[model samples]
Target: MGEFFETYRPQLIYALIVVLSVLLLRFLTNLLYKWLLKQELKKYPNEKPKAVNWVKRILNALWLVLGVIALSSLIVNEDKYDILKHNFKLILYLGILSIVTIVGAASANLWFRVSINRKIQNAEDPTSFKFLRYIAVFGIYITGILFALLAFPSLEGIAKTALGGAGVIALIAGVASQEALSNLVGGVFIISFKPFIIGDIIKVTDTMVGTVVDITLRHTVIRNFENKMIVIPNAIINKEKLVNYNLGELKICERIEIGVAYDSNIDLAKKIMQEEAQKHPLILDNRSPTDILNGNPVVRVSVTSLNDSSVTIRAWAWARNYSEAFDMRCELLEAIKKRFDNEGIEIPFPYRTVVLKKEKETHKNHDAGQTAE
Candidate 1:
């Protein structure tokens, strides 16, 4: 053992130097990163120091790369480690690329998150933020991977070969996955235009009224009134005409119809309907421009139609949302019914009058016979 130690003392010394150098580099990197981070945090208390963090990580990665290169340089003078001298540079390059790729990808993701947090503050649609983050991370990592692959001469040839056939492969893939491609495009448009956000009440059709629960690259999930989820393709959603109840303002105009006897006082009935609407808890106090243009009251009442036996009274009222509007309409109707009963305003039922035509004909014939006699 002593002879072996004596023979390999120089090699052991070289190994020890490399190990110590790497450890020292790591320690310095960590210390520098923390100091920079602390300074950045102190300087911008309100703003996120994510960029600083990313930079620190990148610097640490570069330090490791530098240490590897230094080690390679130190070991090159030793003839016993010929393989390390020749191939270590390639290995170090690949290692550095991998580290840089990972750190850059993570940094990009963190940057995106901070951007989203700042720009989309209090945004109801986190799905858009999440999708955008995924796309950004994917792009960054893919770019990094491509760069890493080019570090090797063999992979460079493979990459060139793949690129040569890329056009044909892309065309075939496009044709094969046309629907998926359309959906992906639609998702992009939806996020950009923001036709509807998560938690919005939407009506795709008469039977498909629901709240938007989730929006993905390919599909949107709607939770219907019956608590069942309806998964709709993004392409279909883009093409179809849909109603977003919560798009502009949360308030909605609700119409409550009531029928009263023709003989009842129409003006009094209108007043009662308006009163009932105003008294409802769910009704909104705010009036719109249309309301002002029409000289609209807090609750509007009009004679919508006259039926065979009754006159239809339509009352328009506003509520904060669809649910509130529905409840307001129901409660207003009940309250109006009670008010009508108290005020002696009758709500008429459907009835038909019939005359005995045969009896009248018999009587007429008898009268004619007596006159002839």
Candidate 2:
């Protein structure tokens, strides 16, 4: 028996020891964690406290991995091992994958804690900050996996071979999707530039008006006064005109068109409108306003169709707030009506001359028809 043992003694002994040690260690670790840490952890009941149990579990898992590797190595001679000798590449790749998983699990609790605290300390909106941090943590894990895939020697060679044509492939893809790429990049641009933040009133090209609800990578969300959201693509926004009301100087111009009887005092009408505008609290009077002038070829409010009684006038006033401007326009119109009524200034409507000859011509044509019949 001694002579027989001496032949395969070391190898047999190592195999037995590896197998026993792996099984015993795994059971012991599980028992220790369940009885010791898990019992205490269950009572404490907070994420950080519970994290310690996860740490122990990860350690147990790592121990199991190493034990398996050791037992497999002991079972076969290095040169003659069918799988171990031929598939060293697979073994290495799996080892890396296991390592990455263990690391990720072990650090997950720490990641959550640190990320949450960072968001809080930054004083950003808690919800947004948390969401961003969560995404960021996931991104880290994804990047870690990618790196692990590349780090394996077997895959590294293949990846290098694939990369040889990557440039040409990328060029073709780039040309084909240039606009799409621009839009994607533009989404990044919108996010970074902060042309408008959530809940800011904005206008684009004098057509759209709303409070910015969200700014995503590809699109902007706006909720207008009517409570309808308008989703505008970042590419469209970046390509065309945009105005962020939040950034503007908080003053806007409003125009009102008024016409007076040609015989009424035009100068008096101008004075009354100016006086009415100046009385408003929100009206900005720091800058002088101009009155209408005659003899403009392109008349914004010309003798556009000379009313038999009145000439037209268009007056503009700049106010501080949109609401204020709109309100003041109503008030200004009321004041103008009162002034016109008192002064008897006629704001006339268009009138056309209808000559009586038309009726007579129609009757004559009817008589001609009768004669032809």
Candidate 3:
């Protein structure tokens, strides 16, 4: 027992130092990450999510790197154990190569994630870049895992039957996950032909309303005007009715329907409407900058509905801004009411005529006889 312990003492110390180094590095990296995140949050107030994700992934990668380096060094020092000294050089090389490769892949993924997000921050379409990010991460992880698996000593069997069986097993596994394969293919289609992007208002159906907040392999994410998020399957979005506000001009039409008593002059009413519309500061007043005598001006009036008591004239104007449109509509309506009242024009209310049947002679006689009695 003494001899065995004596031989293993140096190896045990190396193992202990490796473990301690990795743990210490992990703690330090986490501390640094939080500090950096706080600093970034102060600079870019709206970049909390990006900063948080960046710091987290980078810290994890740093810890992974430290762990891999410690393990590689420890594995190389197995010679000092006095019993493992005569092992082939292949073991040491393999250990170092394997550890270095995994660390490299993780480092690449971290770099890609950070760099891509930076580019995306400046893009008109951030969702496309997000798809690229997913691809980068998946590629790195899968390549690393494949390399790790192939490096396993058991996979190097000399039997041809075993190699053939492994291939067959892989094929079977691939076939069994048909839906997963379809999702992967669908993700590719979605990225290549982007129907929508983040921050774009989209309508998928009659009721699903929101902005495209995120997209993933199996699902697309949407956040409604109420700040509620909904996850829809990619397959559904691929086949549903979708309208993208990102691709079109943002001009929205504000409409007003007004009517006046038939006795009022229609020309004067139209003139008053045109005057009210032009007074608002938000209305675009320039049609040609110079009026042509015969040229029909851009008339905002449309006598749309003809009701019994009044003729409903619809007035519409376009505004370049969405948030300002509703307020403009309200102002225009108040202006119209004040102008109409000033001009002695009444907005007619819905009216009806009641026709009473004529009383018969026999009823009149009965009433006269009662009075005489």
Candidate 4:
């Protein structure tokens, strides 16, 4: 045990120092973070938590860096230890690599998170924010990894060779990641064109109808009415059909179709349809009577079709948004159904009147008599 202690005295002491230093650092950092938060709170009264979180992230990254540096200083002194004399370069390089890796990863995560928060706070469309942030973080860490590799003299030649083949490597990567590149480009186009922003109700496909929750370089995320998230690739979205309900205006035209018996009062049905639609709270009533006469109103009822079974009464109503329009349509349909039932107006179903043939009946009667005899 004595021999073991003697042999590992420097390492054991270094380990103890690192542990103590980390504990002290954390304590100091917490105090500093709180102090900074207090200062930020004074400047940003409404956003104290956000400001504090940002400060805390920065401090956490700094703390990691300081810990690594302090640990390296304790071990790298030539006069203090002969254990690292022969392998000093290798140990130092490894230490530097570890420090860089930790700092790079932590800072990238913190900074990108801050960026995303800022975008959200500014009411910016964040469809591409996550993807762009990830790309930035990946690039930063890849660069850090390359820089760390340079710390080893043995890997310097390999690094130089890689740099020399940069063009060929890029071409290979371009070919291999063709779909990814297309998606990246598609994301940029989507952001630029502003086809649909975050929170817009979009119909990617008949089944994929939902509110756009996010836009990323690779895909667009949608939160459906069922509360399920649907992720569609940006490349595919660009190629496929997309309907943006939030485009142009916040008001939407809702159409409700109802089938009434042909014998029922058509004029009364139209009036009932119009009244039912106008009663809904979601229906927009900004347009004047003049607008209604000019074929634009909160509610309008017309006979759209005359089928063999029934007359189709179409009710058109305006609503504040897509969701409101849907609700208004549903309410109007229910109200119309109840009013029709109460007023004794029949909703028609398909039917055919049967007429018996006299000659066929006589032949059947004669055949029955012959069988009986």
* Candidate 3 residue-wise lDDT, 88-157, digit = tens: 2334444454455545554555555566567667764667666666666565554444444444567544
Q: What is residue 125's positional error in candidate 1, in angstroms?
A: 11
lDDT of 1 by residue, 15-98 (tens): 678778877877887887789678757855665666556656665676566556656665465664666654656656665666
After superposing candidate 1, which stretches have Cα over 4 Å from the reference?
36-91, 120-134, 152-180, 192-194, 197-233, 246-251, 257-272, 279-314, 319-327, 330-373
Clashing pairs in 4: 127-215
Off by over 4 Å in 2: 1-180, 191-200, 259-265, 288-310, 334-343, 350-361, 366-373
TM-score of each: 0.56, 0.49, 0.53, 0.65
Q: What is the lDDT of residue 8 in candidate 2?
A: 85
Write down the lDDT of every candidate, Cα atoms only.
Answer: 0.77, 0.63, 0.66, 0.75
Query: What's the lDDT for candidate 3?
Result: 0.66
> In terms of TM-score, which candidate is strongest?
4
Once fitted onto the true fold, the runs of candidate 4 whose alpha carbons sit more than 4 angstroms away are 1-95, 122-124, 127-129, 145-175, 286-297, 350-373
Which candidate number has the best lDDT? Answer: 1
lDDT against true structure, model 4 = 0.75
Error of 4 at 139 (Å): 1.6
